[model samples]
Target: MTNVLLDAHLNAKLADFAGSSLDGSPLLVVVTKSHRRPGDTCCVEADISAFASTLYTIVTGQSPYHDLSDYKIDERFVHGSFPQTDSLGPLGKLISRCWRDEYPDSKSVCKEIQGMC
Candidate 1:
């Protein structure tokens, strides 16, 4: 069991570094608006956005702006344009809040998710 977990961890690290999933799908690294700016320090908002984006990808099997180039995606994110989430139901709403920086911190996001479950 330890070996299994270690292998999974190593595979995930490799996939992250390689910019693709083990299955060869492109891996999207979620970057928030603040993260795109020069000299901006990492914050809880970034963490929240990342978590939401990752959840979005897991549920949808693709990144929010999977069809766009990195430059285009960054530009859209800077301009506050995010992928539609209506079909995602409750999860979609949560993703929207994270993207919009509505939550105070990552803990609130977790609390909401726990409440959902």
Candidate 2:
């Protein structure tokens, strides 16, 4: 069996070196696999970035435009870059704001999503 503490320690070390929690840096996709439940969908649209982020988590089990590069997962979160994913469906436009800086901040992004919803 895997030592849970060891696993957590390793993950923490990796995150510390990878700048996963750094500000002004790309949001990292910490979780390797999608944690969303089957048929899970995000429909909550609010004027709060936290809420928007929550909604995004519900849909993809990831932060908006996550990096995930350290884990050998490529999310392609380059500046002014956006990838096409069918999972987002109608939420694509709203999530695009994270890549394109469409919103001044997360709050604005949430507002945009709320409008779309």
Top lDDT: which candidate number?
Answer: 1
Task: For residues 1-117, write the lDDT of model 1, one tens digit per residue.
Answer: 011122644442212333224554533653343223212225556557766777777678776787877778778777888889989988999998888889998788889889889
- Per-residue lDDT tens digits for candidate 2, residues 34-91, read 2211111221121232333444655675554465443222323323233443468767
**Model 2 residue 65 lDDT?**
44
- Per-model root-mean-square deviation over C-alphas: 9.1, 12.3
In model 2, residue pairs whose N, Cα or C atoms come closer than 3 Å (at least 3 residues apart or on different chains), thus clashing, are none
Clashing pairs in 1: none
| After superposition, candidate 2 runs with Cα above 4 Å error | 1-57, 61-75, 79-81
